[model samples]
Target: MAKKESYESRVEAFLLPLMEENHFELVDVEYVKEAGTWYLRAYIDKEGGIAVDDCEVISRQLGDWLDKEDFISESYILEVSSPGLGRPLKKEKDYVRSMGREVEVRLYKAIDRQKEFTGILSAYDDKTVTLTMGDGSAQTFEKAGIALIRLAFDF
Candidate 1:
């Protein structure tokens, strides 16, 4: 696998169980270098929301576990935080639950000459998502066509 994919897989293996044990969902993770420091940032969240205290607790616990494993050789900063508004839709379950919410989606190829769409997520079914466009027109997109999907925080 590619370096980034390998890193993500390793980190996911190490952290997923920890997040599940704490009743939190693992939103996403990034291993990147910024200003000469490698950062391992884990975005976590729950049903309602997440708070600083939750981040602190999970960060401390996960930090202890990471230190013991020593999976990362370079000096890296670890961060655990909420996904916040406009959170990514990482899982199929997330897409299902986000029905009726606004979403922004990018497709691998243009469907009807457009590769991107932003609208209300009217429904999500077995293999497609129905979107209500700004003009009140509804369209269905196959899951395989989606390249990126995220909640649209119009607030």
Candidate 2:
């Protein structure tokens, strides 16, 4: 597997249990280097909405746990926040939940000669998402084919 995948796996393993215990959903994790230091961002979500207190609490606890584990040697910023309105669909469950909703998807490679599409999500199995395009055409995309998946801004 690629290094980014490995890093994401480790981060997910380390954070999921803690999130479950705290009644928060783990939306995503981004580990990237900008300028000089590495940054670790954890996107989180909960019913109703996430508050500042929620982010602060998770940040503190996860920061401590990350320090104890020492999985990352480089200096980094640990951020915990809500996924927001255009939240990404990162898991199979997420895609399933988004069925019938408008979505914007960018593919790793072109499908039918297009690399991007904005349409209504028709269905999602564990492996693929079927999108109905503006012209009433449908296309199926394996999960691995997506570069990014997010809610579309209809307005």
Q: What C-alpha lDDT do the candidate models reach, one value each?
A: 0.85, 0.86
Worst 10 residues of 2 by lDDT: 1-10
Tens digits of per-residue lDDT, candidate 1, 73-100, equal: 7888898889888787777778777888
Q: Runs in model 1 with CA error above 4 Å? A: 34-36, 106-116, 122-130, 139-148
Per-prediction backbone clash count: 0, 0
Weakest ten-residue segment in model 1 by summed lDDT = 2-11
Q: Tell me how candidate 2 scores on lDDT.
A: 0.86
lDDT of each residue in 13-127, candidate 2, tens digit only: 8889988998988988888888987778989888888999999998998788888888676678787889888898877768777889999999999967999999999988778
Clashes of 1: 0
Please report how far candidate 2 places residue 1 from its true position, in Å. Answer: 6.2
